[model samples]
Target: MKDHTGKPVYFDEEFREISLMLLKAKTRWQIDQLKQYADEAIIFIDEPILSALGSSSYLGVSETETARLLKELIDVIKNEGGISGIHCCGNADWPMAIKCGPDIINFDAYDYAGTLALYPEEFRGFLEKGGYLAWGIVPTSEAIAGENPESIRKRFEQGVEKLSLHIPKDLILSNIMLTPSCGTGTRTVEETIKVFQLLMRLKEEYA
Candidate 1:
């Protein structure tokens, strides 16, 4: 229905005229413009097509169509030498996402760690094809934000243990990324800062 790119755009039903690739192109242009004033950092574009695919509004489109759109957008970003990530916090079309060419797959690993782990064939295929798993382990809510790094680290380790059934420890570490369970936009600014500081401390200890 609406563009999920965190912009101020309020789209009407008429806005469905735009294709997803065009949306990615416009967003990429905006990112390029912002790069001049921001610090150097990896850029990720959230298309949310998979989430859309599962919605009633998008029921008219086939999975293949959505995947094709995602593939085209990912190719454009890859050609521009940009790191690309797709965030699908809810249930997603993972097999489709893997083939669509996202370098990073951001998912709720803290809760659904076993879902991916048990799917050995799919998980192995994704790993072999060079897709990294951005595990959403750190909680972002005010209530869960008070968790200590040790507890978070242990949760991550446990996830590793489960994932080890399909992948080796070294291989998992190479492709693993730790992230907040979700965006902190719903939380207070203080909680967001705390998440950053906690992550920094983990980096120092792990690095």
Candidate 2:
């Protein structure tokens, strides 16, 4: 495959081995953090890569393998007494993600909430099995400049309203969380601060 700069990248055997090693190391570190800090940890496996899974560039990637990898980590997290979540910053195969058996599903609700809503039956089953949905309603980009808590809240309610058509409103509401659309790492400090402030204000109202 070629990267954004069109540089050739290979997912050869050596690369696959290194990737697995890295994943294992990361998982161990997360488990240690869980053990050291809190009785229960909410660990999110942020896989922005899933957003590109079905794209032409990743057509060779197997969906089954992807699901297996996610489920393997999720199983370990749960077995170690942690809540596991998967965050995909863009639209992907929502049903596939759900089938991975994560305790939570986090998505860019600010832009792609409807994408998940399209899988009503799958989402309903997930929720019924005590899965949570982390709604990433706060924008992490310049778009944040045009948003406030009220607008964000309104958008969230609208998303819920759409999902409530097939799933019980109470079920959806009871198992929901809020988050930024993605990490704010690339944003300016001022923008990052605003993002948290908006998130806190929304949390206060909802709480």
Best-matching candidate per TM-score: 2
Question: Which residue segments of model 2 deviate by more than 4 Å?
Answer: 1-10, 13-18
lDDT tens digits by residue: candidate 1, 23-123: 77775786677668764324565554565676887666678766776777777666665667777765677777877878888877666676676466776
- Please list all clashing residue pairs in model 1, or write none if there are none: none
lDDT, candidate 1, at 61: 68
**Candidate 2, which ten residues in sequence have the lowest lDDT sum?**
7-16
Model 2: pairs clashing at backbone N, Cα or C within 3 Å: none
Residue-level lDDT of model 2, residues 1-207, one tens digit each, is 445666433345565546666776787678777688788888899988898987898888789878987888888778778889999989978899999999999999899988877888999999999999998999997899999888988998898888888889999989999889999998999999999999999889889
lDDT of the structure predicted as candidate 2: 0.86
C-alpha RMSD in Å of predicted model 2 compared with the true structure: 2.8
RMSD in angstroms, candidate 1?
Answer: 4.6
lDDT of 1: 0.71
* Best model per lDDT: 2
